[model samples]
Target: MTERFASLMERKLPMLDRLAVITARDQYVRKVLIPMFSDEALDSEVRTAFQSGAGGYIYQVDTLNTAELKLILQEYSWADIIEGEPQLFTQVFHVVQHSPDEAFRAEVLAEIGPYAERGEIDGQEYALMYDRVELAAGRQQLYGSQLECLNGQFDVHDLKDPEGVDARRASMGMQPLQDYLEQGRALYGPC
Candidate 1:
């Protein structure tokens, strides 16, 4: 890591480390742990245990992490947490993006604009959240970064202007909408 990155991380090590732990549990439950339990080959009883136990754990952590992250955002700007270490943006953004509060997400979306402009955070990250906020508000998304699963097929959410979407996405360093949808389909198959 760069010197600034190391310094910032050390100063905020406790918060950042805790975020890492939360992310690990979050991803594990959704990815590896849940899948292990849901395997059709597994006994139903074991699956039930995983569902009750791990599922509860996910809810508990999500609530706790959301509260903690909200407090952190109240205390610090995104630049304070992410200016030196661009990578740290992922940790903070993951929490903000997954937050159940649409209002909070919208607030964070506004907060991120200047940082994205200054190149402190990835523009794609900003674009993703922008699309999410727009979709939540029943407005058309500009960058085509948000996708929806409609009738078991994943497709980009409605765009503000279909003709300008590719240019907007490119401005944010994102690929064409078609390429993004194709990649998602390739990786996750139709859902």
Candidate 2:
């Protein structure tokens, strides 16, 4: 990921929760990650998984173990059941309000910078990181107004307005992470 994009994400969304869901079908493998974004359904899964004592929010599975998941992917032709590079997946959703406090921003930058520097994340991933931060910040803005307090401050107007929020949610729901990653893999091959 470009330094510019990383900087943006740090400036926007400082607090984030990352969830990685792994599934396998036959010989094909996939990993779905929720990149600091929130959706009711996704949140519920995370919460339940956590409450049920799943540690670290990472789900790992063998291709031979999840026959149903593999079958589902095959049905959509999103992946071929073959040994190959593991695909990275993530879904971005739900905007929440966030504070631009210097300390908070610094902490976020510290956490993400190393990964970007190592090439573990690319420009697109950086962009998605920023997008999730913006969405969260937007939600925080709404909450602030409802509470009659301005705890979290953000200047991105698109996320603060109702129309913008609806638009953002719609866009997020339009594509599943599996589909998005499949398309990207097809276009770019193993990134």
RMSD to truth, every model: 4.5, 17.8
Give per-residue CA lDDT, model 2, range 1-191, as digits (tens): 48876774464332121212222221122223322222233455564454344223222333223333333333422112111211232221100012223233234434554554554434344434454454445534321112211232112233355545444433433333334434443432221
Cα deviation of 22, candidate 2, in Å: 2.0
Best by lDDT: 1
> Clashing residue pairs in candidate 1, if any?
none
**Per-candidate local distance difference test:** 0.76, 0.32
lDDT of model 2 at position 163: 47
lDDT of 1 at 96: 73
Name the Cα RMSD for model 1: 4.5
Give the top-scoring candidate (TM-score): 1
